[model samples]
Target chain A: MFYVPVSSSGGDTVNTGAAITPAQYVQHHLEHLTLNLRTFRVGDLQEAQGFWVLNLDTFLVSLILGIGLVVFLRFVAVRMREVPGGLQNFVEIMVGFVDKSISEVYHGKSKLLAPMSLIIFMWVFLMNAMDLLPVDLLWRILDLFGVTYFKNVPTADPNVTFAMSLAVFFLIIFYNIKIKKFHLAKEMLTVPFGGYLFPLNLVFRLIEECVKPLSLALRLFGNMFAGELVFILIALLPWWGQGLPGGIWAIFHILVITLQAFIFMMLTVVYLSMAHDTH
Target chain B: MGINATLIGQFITFAILVWFTMKYVWPPITQAMHDREKKIAAGLEAAERSKRELEMAERKAMSIIRDAKQQATHIIDEASRHSVLLVEEAKQQAKEEGARMIELAQHEISREVTQAKEVLKTQLATLVVAGAEKVIQRHLDASAHMALLDELVAEI
Candidate 1:
C-alpha cells in the first residue's frame, strides 16, 4: 500500500505536495515560450520568436466551447415550433438581446450584423463557459490515456484568442475594402494629416489595424486566465479552507464566465459593424 | 506560440459551429416563440367568451326575477277585484230580500185592515136591521116583515 501525504494548513487538510508545489504547478501552467524557434526568419522582427508562446489551455477549452455552441443551437433548432417551449424560449430571448445590440451598433443593414452578432454571442459565451470546468479535469483524463500535459482552455491561451481576433480583424479589413475600395483607403490617408503626408497616414492606419487583433485577443485571454487563476487558488485551500472558498468562488465565477463571454461576443459584433461603416 | 497544426483545427471548428447554428437552430426558435404567443392569445379569447356567457346568465336571472314579481302583482290585483265583486253581490242580494219582506208585510196589513172594515160595516147594518124589525113588528104583522126582508134581499 502506498501512502499519499496530505498537509493541514489553516486547520484544514489539503492535498498538496503529493502532486506538486503550488508555485511550480502555477508556473508550469503560466509559462509560455517567449519566441517561436520554428518560425524564425531573418526579416522577422528580432523580438518575435522569443515572444510568449500560445497558452494550450485557452485553445482546448475554446474548441470544446465551440462544439457546445453548435450542439446547443442544434437542440434549439430541433425543438423550434410556432410555439416555444422552455429551451426555445430561452434561446429566443438571448438571440433577441444579441440582435438588438448589433442593430444599435451596426446601423446600415440588419441583414449581416444581426446573424453575425448572434453567432458571436453564442460562440464566445460557449468559450467563456469553458472556465467553469475544473482546470485539471481534461489533463487528468488525458493522463489516464498517457497524455499528461493537455491544457483545456483555449481563450486563456493568448495565441488562440489573438488568432480569433485577427481573423475578425482581417474580415473587417476585407469588408472595408469591399465597401470603400481603393478609393476609400486613399481618401482615409488624405483626410487626417492630408494627402501630402500619405506615408505617415498609411503607417498610422496599418498600426491601428494591427492593434485591433492584439487588443481583442488580450482582453479575452486576460479575463479568462484571471478567472482560471482564482479557481486554482481556491482549489489549493485545505478542507474547510479550500472547499468552502472554492465553492463560494465557483458560484461567483458563473456570472464572470457568462459576462466575459458576452463582452467578447458583443465586441466582435461592434468591430464587424465598425468595419462595415463608411466614415 | 507558433502557427502550428492546431490553428487549422481551431478554424475548422469555428466554421462548423457557425454553419450548424445557422442551419439547425434559428428558424425553429423563432417559430416556437410565435406559436407560444398565439396560444396565449387563444387562451385570452376563451376567457373572454366565458365572461360574456356569465354576463348573459346574470341577465337571464334578473329577467326571471322581474317576471316573477310582475306575475305576483297581477295575481294580487285579481284577487282584490274578485273579493270586491263577491261583497257587492252579497250586499245587493241582502237589500232585495229586505225589500221583498217589507212588501209582503205591507200587503198583509192592508188585507187585514180591509177585512176588519167589512166586518164592522156588516155589524152596523145588522144592528139597524134589528131596530127596523122591532119597529115593523110592532106596527104590522109578521107576514109584512118577511115580505120586506125578501124585497131587501132582492135589491142587494
Candidate 2:
C-alpha cells in the first residue's frame, strides 16, 4: 500500500492510524515477496509457505545486482589501458585498494581472493545501500504492478548474508584443509591445552569453526536489518518530521553499510590468511 | 523471517558470482593492474634516464659553446696583432726609402761642385801665362809651356 505522507505538521500520525495501522505498515514493509519452492510459483499462499519457501525478492535482487557487479567490473577490466581515463581511474582506485588488502592479509598466490573481496565489498555495499532508499519507494512502485511483500535490501535478509558467509566459511575450511593437511587436525586437538584433552579440544574447535559463518552472517544481517528498520520507522514519522532524523540516520548508515562491507571483506581475507599460514 | 530455500538460491547466485568473478573479473583486472604498475615503473625509469642524458647533453653543449667563444677571442686577438705588425712594417719601409733618396741627391750635388772647381783651376793657369807674357814684353813658346802648364796643374 502506498502511504499518504503527513499533511499536518502539528500532530503525530503513528497513533492516529490514518490509512492503515502503523503496526500493519511496519509489518507489511518487513515481509518479503516470496516464491513458494514446492509449487515453484510466485504467489502469496501463506498456508504452505514454510521451509520450502524462497524469497524471490532476495534471490532476484541479489542475482541481478551480482550480475550487474560482474558486468561493471568486467566493463572496467576490458576497458583498462596503460593510461587510465575517467571511469578507469575510479575503478582502478578500488581495484588497487582491494589488491592491497588481499596482499596484506593473504600472502598466498591466488587470483580469486581480490576479485572475491571486490565482489563482496561492492555488491554488499550496493545491497546495503538499498536501506538508504525511501523504504516505501520500491514497494509503492512495485505495488502498483500488483506485487506486494517486497523487502528491497538483500543484505537485510539473513539468507543472502548467510549465503555470502557460507561461501567464506567454505573457503576457510578449504584452505585450512588444503594447506595444513594433517597438521590442521593435530592443531585442532592439541593447540589450547594438551593432547590428553583432545576430546575437549575437538569440541571447542568445532564450536569455534561453526561460529565463523554464524558471526559474519549475523553481524551483517543485524546491522542491515537494524538500518532497514530504522528507515522504516523514520518513514512512519510525520512527513515534515521525517527529514531531519531520516537524513541523519542515512548519513550515519552510509558509514555503517560501507564499514560492514569492508569488515566482511577484511575478515574474509584474514580468515584466508589464517587458513594460508601455518600458525 | 525464517530460514528457507532462499538460502539455496542465494548460494547459487553467490556461486555464479564467485565463478564469474574468478573467471572474468578478478584475474584480468589484477593482471591489468599489475601490468599498469610495471608500465608505470618502466616509464619512470625511462624518464629518469632521459633526464640524466639531457643534463649530460646540456653540460656538453655549454662546454662546446665556451670553447668556441674562447677560440673566437683568440682569433680576434691574433688578427689585431697581425694588423699592428703590418702597420709598423709599412712605416719602417717608408722611412728607409726617404733616407736613400736624400743621400743620392747630396752625392750628385757634391760631385758636380768638384768638377766645377777643376775647370776653374785649368782656367787660372792659362790666365797666369798671358799675364807673364805681357810683363816680359816678348812672345813665349806655347808648346814648351804646355809641359810646364801640366806640372803646374798637378801642383795646383
Candidate 3:
C-alpha cells in the first residue's frame, strides 16, 4: 500500500517542447533516474516496476553527499584546534549535540550509537536540505545536458529512508539478542500479555518490532517527500508567482528538514535503548 | 517510485557511511571534544589551586612580617638594658677614682706640715741653744740643753 506511485496522473510530454501541464510537470519531477540490474527480463526501468531496478539519481546524489559529509568532517577533525573556529566549530557543535542526545537517551554503553546517530542526523539533514535548492534550477541544468528524471533529495525516496531505518532495525534486534540473550524469545512470546497468550503476544511483538522501522522510515520519507512535492508544485506556477510562495515554503521547510533529521536520530536512539532494556 | 535495488544500494551506502564514520569521522571529532573538555577542567582545577596557593602565601608573608617586628622590639629592649648597665659601671669607677685622689692630697698636706714642724723645731732648738750657751756662759751647760730638747721633741 505504501508503494503506490506518488506522481500525479500525467502522460509523458517530453520532445513535444509544449508547455507541460501541472500534473506532467509534477510527474516529471517525481521520476527517478533508474537502472535495471535484473538477470532476467522484467518490466521497463522507466516504469520503475522492476524489482531489481536501481534509482541511480538517488544513489548518486546520496553517495556524493555522504562522501562530501565525511570529507568535510574529516577535514575538520584533522585540523581541529582547542580554540575552534568556522567549520571545525560547526562540526564540533553538531558532534557534541549528537553525543549529548545519545548519552541522554541511550543509557547503555554502545560505542556505535553516537557515531551512528551523528551520521544519520547529518546525512538526513543534508539530504532534506537539498529541497531548499531551486527545483527548476537543477532541472534546467540537467535539461541543458539532455537529461531528465533527476530527484536530488534522497530522503524523499522511501527506499533510502527504509534502508537507513532497516539498518537501525537490525541493530535494535542485534542489541535485543545481545542484551536479553535467551530471554528475548521468551519475552517476545510473553510480555504485555502473559505466557498463556503466547501466539497473540508473538503477533503483537512482530507488529511492534515492524512498527519501529516503519515509523522511522515513513516519518522522514513522508516529510521530505511532501516538502519536495510542495517545491515542485510551487515551481509549476508562473516564474514570478513562484517567488513568494516558494520563498515562504522554503523558509518553513528549514524547520521541517531539521526536525525530521532530529526525529530520526532521536527515534534511532530510543529504539536502540529499548532494545538494550531488559524485559 | 516502486521499491527496487536502490534500497539495497542505499543499505550498502549506509553501511559504508556508518563504517567510515565509526572508524574515521566520528572518533577524532569526539576525541577532540573530550580532550577539550578535559583540558578545560584541568585549567579550572589549576586556577583553583593557584588561588589557594596565593592565599596561603599571603598568610605566610603576614606571619613573617609579624615575627620580624617582634624580633626587632626584642633586640631594642636588650640594647637598652645593656646601656643602662654600662652607665652604672662608669659611675662607680668615677667615685672610686675621686676618693683615691682626695686621700693622696690629704696625705701630701700632712707630710708637708710635718716637715715644716721639723724645721721650726730645728730653728727653736738652735735659738734655745744659742741662748743657753749665752746663759750657760753666764749660768748653765750644753748637756742639760740637749736633755731639754729631747723632752720637748717627745712632747710635740
Candidate 4:
C-alpha cells in the first residue's frame, strides 16, 4: 500500500497544469526504472530482473551533484591560503572540523580516515543539500525539454542510498576480513556464548552487519524524501499564500540541509572509524 | 504507473562522478593544501632570516663606530703629547741662546775699557815732554849765566 498526501489533490493552481489525482502524482514521483522488463516488482528482489536496468534521473542528479561538489571544493582548495579569506575560510573551517573529528575517532589511522571522511562528508552533504532546492524548479526546467518525471534529490532513492551505504559496509567488512582474516570468521560463527546462545550471537552479528546499510540508506533517503514531499506540498498552495509558508520553510530548511549534511558526514567518519577497529 | 527511466541515469551519473572525484579531484586538492602550507612556512623562515641579517648588520655598524671613536681618541692623545714635547724642547733652546748672547756682550765691553785707559796714559807723557823742551830752551840763555854761576858755586 502506498501513502498519498492530501495536498496533491485539488492543488493545481496554474492554468497550464493538468489535473492529477493524489495517487497519480505520488506514483509519478515514486516510479523508478527497474531491471524487470517483463515482470514489474515493487520492492521484491527475488525476481531477477534484466541486466541493463538503470535509473536515468538518479544518475544525472548524482553526477551533477558530485561534479558540483568536486568543482566547488577544487575552487576552494585552489584559492585556499594559510590565512584563509572568504569561501576559502569556510572550506578550511569545514576541513578542520572534519579533520578534528577523524582524529578523535581513528587518531592513529588519520592518514586514511581524514581524506575518506572529508569526501564522504562533502559529497553526501551536497547530495542531501540538493533536496533544499525547490522540487518544481528542476521539473520546470526539464519540462521545457519534455522530461517531466524527475526527482532532484538523489539520496532519496533507495538504490543510490543503499549504494553509498554498501560502499561503507563493504569497506567495514573488507577491513574486518583483512584484519581478522577468514579464519576468524569461522571461529566467530562457531564460538559458543553458552549452550543455545551460540546461535543468538551469530544472529546478532548478522543483524548488526545487515543494519549498517539499511540504517545508512534509510536515514538519508527518508530525510531527503520527506523534505522533498514537504516542498511539493508547499508548492501546491496558492501562489500568493505559498510565498509566506514556502519562504519560511525555505529559510528553516537551510539549517536542516546543512545540519543533515554535517550529521551524515560525521556518521560516515564514525562508521569508518568503527570499521578500522576490531569488534 | 510506469517507472521513470531518468532515475537510473542519475544514479549512474552520480556514481561516475563520485568515482572520478575520488580518483582525480581529491589528489590535486590535497596536494594544493599541502603546497600552500609549505609556502607559508618558507615565507616565515625567509622573513626571520632577513630580520636576523638586518640585526647583524646593525651590530656590525655599531662596533665600527665604537672602534673609530677609540682610534680618534688615541690620535688626539698622541698629537697632544708631541706638542708638549715640542714646547719643552723650544724652551730649553731659547734659554741656551740667551745665555750665549749675554756672555759675548760682557767680553766686548771689557776690551773697550782697557783700550781707553792705555790711550789716556800715553797723552799725559807727551804733555810733560813738551814742557821740558820749553824749559831747556830758556835755560840755554842761562847757559852763559851758568858759566858765571858755576864759577860762583866753585868759589863757594
Candidate 5:
C-alpha cells in the first residue's frame, strides 16, 4: 500500500549515449532527494537506505508549503476586517466556503474539522499547483545546488498523501473511540450483519475503516502522480510540439487540482462525520 | 519511493498546520463578519427610529399650526367686536352730551330774559314817574316815594 518502486536507476546522465531516453527522464523526475538519517548524508539518486531515511524533498516541500500557507492564512486572519479587501477577502471567501462545505457534510460540531479541511484543501491545492510549473523547473534549480534527485509535487508522493490521510484516519479512530465509546465496539462487531455474523462484521468493519484512509490517500496520489507523469511525458516531446497538449493538460489540470483538493476535504469530512455518527 | 520518516515528518507538519489554523486563523474573520452584521442591523434600526420620529414631529407640528391658526382667527374676531362696541359707546355719550348742553343753554336764556324784563320794567316805572311829575307839575321827593314806586314796578 505504501511502496513506490524506483522504476529506473543511475538517473543522473550516466548513459554512454548522448541524450537520455524518455524512460530515464521519467525515472529521474520520480526520484526523491532522500536524506539518509543513519548515514548523516543525502542520497545520490540511490534507493532509500532504511526506514529511518527521510525523503527530504517531499517532507520539506510539504512542510514549507504547509507552513507557508498556514502562516499566510494566519497573517490574513490576524489582519481580518469587517469589510474585507484583497487577500483578506479571498481568504474569507475560501474559509467561508470550506466552513459551509464542512457544515453541509459534517453535521457534528467539532472545532478541528473545519480548519483541518481548510488547510487540507488549500495545502493540497498548492501542492497540486506545482504540477503546472515546468516539470524540469524545480529540478534544474535544485540541481544547480548540486542536489541529484527531487520530486517537486509532494502529493504525488504516497508517503505525503498517506501521511495526511493517516492523520485523518487517526482522528476518525479517536472520535469513534471518544464519542461512541462502548457502542463503537458493539457496532464494529455487529454492523452490516446480524449478531450471528459478528466476526464477519468485525472483519468487514476493519476493511471498511481501513479503506477510508486507503482510498483517500490513493485517490489523491494517483491523480497527482498521473498528472505529474503526463507532464513529464509531455516534456519528452519536441519543445515546439509540447505546448499544445501541455497547455491543454495544464488547463484541464487546474480543474483536476481543485477538484482533488476539494474531494480530499469532502471525503475527510464525510468520513469523520461517519465516525461521529451512531451508524 | 517507500514509506519512511517522511510520513512522520509530513504528519507532524500537517498536524501543526491544522493546529495553527484552528488556533490562529479561523475565529477573527468570522468574528469580524458577525460584528459587521450586528452593526448593519443596528444602523438600519436607527434609521427606522429616526424616520418614525420625524413623521411624528411633522404631525405634531401640523397640529400645532392648526391650533395656532384657529386661535389667531378667534382673537381677530374678538378684537373687531370690541372696537365696534367702543365706537357705539362713544357715539351714545356724544349725543347725550349735546342734549345736556342745549338744556343748559335754554335755562340760561330764560334767566337772562327774566332779568332784562325786570330791569326794563323798573326803568319804565322810573320814566312814568318822571312824566307824571312833569304833567302834574308837582315835585314830590323821589326818594320818599321809593316804596310805592318799587311796588308799582313790581306790579308792572
Candidate 6:
C-alpha cells in the first residue's frame, strides 16, 4: 500500500492519501460502500466478487434523504397555515409544481399520481443536489470513521434508479389491467401490426412496455453519473486550480440536476397516463 | 454500481415514502387548498348577492318616494277642487238671497199702495154726497128734487 503525507499547521504529520495516483483517486471516489449479502461481508470493494451485493452507501444515503423528505413534509403538513412562510412556503411551491406537472400530463383522476410524482421529483432532486457538496469533504470525514468507499448521489447508482422506475412500471401494468381489462390482452396481440402479425405485435408491444421504465432509469442514471464523473475529474486537479472549473460546473449543473429530476417525473406521469388510455 | 439488493431496498423505501406521504401528508394539504378555494368562491358570491340586494332596496326607496310625491299631488288637487266648490256654493247662495229680498220689498210696497187708494176713494164719495144736499135745499122745491138727489146718491 502506498501513502502520501500531509503537513499540519501544528508541525504534526497525517497520512491522508488512501490512493497514491490520480487514477486511484477517481476510482476511490467512484467506488461504492457495498455489502456482499450472500457472503455476509459488509465492506466488500472487490469489483468482480459477489452475486448478491448491496450498495450500502446508496441505500443508506437514499433512505436518509427519503426519510428526511417524509419528515420535513410531515412537519409542513402538520403546521400548514393558510398564510404560509419559510419552509412551509418552500415545500408548498414544490408540492404545487409537482401537482401542476401531474395535472398537465395525467388527465385521469388518481390521488396517487400527484404525491407520488412529488416524492419522485423531490427525492431524486435532493439526491442529485448532493453532488454540489465537495466530494473530498465527505470522504475525509468518513475516513476518520474508518469508512473507505462511498458514493453520495443515489440517483447516480443504476440500482436506485431502476428501483424507482420499476415501481412506475408496476403502476403502468396495474392501470392497463384496471382500465382495459380483457381488452388489454387483445390490444397487445392485435393493434399496431394487426391480428395477422401477432408474433411481431407481441414483440413490439413488449419492447414498448419495457422501454418506458428503461428509458426513465437510464436517463437519470446517465446524467447524474456523468455529472459525478465531471466533479471527480475536477477534483483531480491541484487544490488551487480546482475552484474555477468546479464553481462553473456546479452552477451549470444546477439546471442539469433539476432537469433530470423533472424528466424522470414527467416520464412517469406520461407512462401512467398511457396505461389509463384506451386503445 | 450494478444489480444488487439495494434495488429492492430502494424500492421498499420508495414504497414506504409514498405510503407515508399519501396517508399523512397529501390529504390534509390538498384538502386545505380546496377548502380555501371554496371559501373564496362563497365569499365572492355572498358579496355579489348583497350588492344586488342593496341595488334593489335603493330602487324600492326611489319608487316609494315617487309614489308619495304622486299621492301628495293628488291630495293637493283634491283639496283645491274642494275649496273651489265651496266658493262657488257660497256665491250661488248669496245670489239667491239677494233675489228673495228684492221680491219681498216689492210685495210690501204694492200692499201699502192698495190700502191708501181704497181710503182715498171712500173719502171722495162722502164729500160729493154732502155738496149735492146743500145745493138742492137752497134753489128748488124740497119735495120735488128729493127723488132725483136720492137717485144720484145711489149712483155715486
> What lDDT tens digits, residue by residue, belong to model 2 across residues B1-156?
778888988888888887888898777776888888898899999999999999999999999999999999999999999999999999898889889888988898889889877887667777766655664455456666667666876787
User: Interface RMSD, all models, one decimal each?
Assistant: 4.3, 1.1, 0.9, 4.7, 1.0, 1.1
**Highest-lDDT candidate:** 5
**Model 4, span A109-161: residue lDDT tens:** 43444655676677777777777777667765765654535677777776676
Q: Write the per-residue lDDT of candidate 1 for residues B10-117, one digit (tens) a residue.
A: 656665666566566655555666677789999999999999999999999999999999999999999999999999999999999999999999999999998987
lDDT of 6 at A141: 76
Q: Write the per-residue lDDT of candidate 5 for residues A74-157, one digit (tens) a residue.
A: 789788776779998789889889988988878887989988999999999999998898888787776556676778999999
Predicted model with the maximum DockQ: 3
Model 3 chain A lDDT-worst window of ten: A1-10
- All models, RMSD in angstroms: 9.4, 6.0, 5.5, 8.7, 5.9, 7.3
lDDT of 6 by residue, B42-137 (tens): 999999999999999999999999999999999999999999999999999999998998898889888888877667656656665566557665
- Identify the CAPRI category of the predicted complex in candidate 6: medium
Show where candidate 2 strays beyond 4 Å: A1-20, B68-155
Q: Kindly indicate the candidate among 1 and 5 with the higher DockQ.
A: 5
TM-score-superior candidate, 1 or 6: 6
Candidate 1 regions with alpha-carbon error over 4 angstroms:
A1-19, A30-61, A110-112, B1-3, B31-156
Q: Which ten residues in a row have the lowest lDDT in candidate 3 chain B?
A: B138-147
List the candidate 4 regions with Cα displacement exceeding 4 Å: A1-53, A68-104, A108-116, A180-206, B1-15, B108-156
Instruction: Please tell me which predicted candidate would have the highest TM-score against the true structure.
Output: 3
Q: What is the DockQ of candidate 4?
A: 0.15
Q: Give fnat for candidate 6.
A: 0.76
List, residue by residue over B12-116, the lDDT tens digit for candidate 5. 889989898888887776677678879999999999999999999999999999999999999999999999999999999999998999999999999999999
DockQ of 1: 0.16
Measured against the true two-chain complex, the DockQ scores of the candidates, in the order shown, are 0.16, 0.56, 0.65, 0.15, 0.60, 0.52
Per-candidate local distance difference test = 0.66, 0.82, 0.84, 0.64, 0.85, 0.84
How many backbone clashes does every candidate have? 24, 0, 1, 22, 0, 0
lDDT of 3 at A69: 91
- Which is better, 3 or 4, measured by lDDT? 3
